[model samples]
Target: INSSIRSTYFVSKLRRISQIFYIELTPNKNLIMSVNGIYAEDSEGKFIPATQRPDGTWRKPRRVKDGYVPQEEVPLYESKGKQFAARKPQLPVGMSPEVALASRSKKSGPNVHCPIPGLVVLEDKTKKKKKKKDATVEKLANDLTQTKLDNTPPDPAKRLKNLKKKIREIESIEARLLSGELKCPEKDQLDKVARKIEILCEIKEIEKQIYWPIDTKYDFCRRL
Candidate 1:
């Protein structure tokens, strides 16, 4: 019974030693163990020695199990956004990539930042155009008012004489049309008729103004 117990103890110790040896000879670099501590491969395929702290305790090397990567082997992180593509200018059709890049660099001035090849930043001109349009309309209105003031004679008798002369001229034009003496285009005939009507309406308005002038005092009393 004592021989069997001694053999069992010896077998257990031998198994432990074999397991340790097997771990050391394993193909997995991450699981490899050394005399000091765990070993890790660096970027240059060199094995980094285990670290130690000032307290005489071993500092653990970062490992896959710890969810940590070695500093030297960490990959650079990149964003997959469209703005990332904007860094490189696009080449125009029928142009070589080299020439396109060269032209883009030349056109992109020092102050401009990341200018796209085909895009142009244009200044907004809507407000300026609206202001110019408004000024033109105002000028046209002023010119029309000034023309009306210049055309009207200051003396009422002179204005009445002018109105009568326009009526006579329109009557002669109508008589020539009835007698088939004057030839005119359809549009010109219509325009002349319209002008005659406008002149008659203006003469009637002048007569009314002269014969029936409004009394402001009477109008105020009526409003009250």
Candidate 2:
């Protein structure tokens, strides 16, 4: 029984050692070769066979003596897109030279300009139209300016009186608002009137300080 147990233990140890050795020797499953043979990546993370020098001259299969590598011989880019191709010109047989020339030549239109220099010169195509002001709008603007001038008081006392009147009107509206008599009182209008009142009061104070009682040269001369 002791011999059997020892043999079984040796076998398990050998299996584990074998597994470790195999893992060390085997390549990683993730390191796979490219499907297409266009190019392969190396351990350095560079494409192999490596890209050719940029200074290399382009060549065609027609020549063999010039020592130029044929363009077809060079490997194509890995991510190369669709090949370029040009469309062939369509022409009708038995057509006159002048008719063919005319067909090729672009027709002169509103946008198209003549390519023949010193033969046909294109003038400025943009035509600006003059816009006339509406008489009604002009009259309204004039009336607005006249109304502003007429409403504005020239004297500080008159201006202050006007401001005070506007303030009283605003206060009455505010009182109505507080009493819920008026649903929506113009807060902005009230604020404007209040600001005007403050400004007028300041202007009146400044005028009072600026005007002082002093005997002038004219007054002295009149007394003499």
Backbone collision tally, model 1: 0
Residue 156, model 1: lDDT of 66
TM-scores vs. true structure, each candidate:
0.25, 0.21
Worst 10 residues of 1 by lDDT: 215-224
Off by over 4 Å in 2: 1-153, 187-190, 193-200, 203-224
What tens-digit string does per-residue lDDT give for candidate 1 at 9-38? 786667557645644564654444545445
Hey, what RMSD does candidate 1 come out at? Answer: 18.4
lDDT for model 1 comes to 0.61
| Per-model CA lDDT versus the true structure | 0.61, 0.50
Local lDDT at 26 for model 2 = 46
Taking all chains together, the TM-score of candidate 2 against the true structure is: 0.21
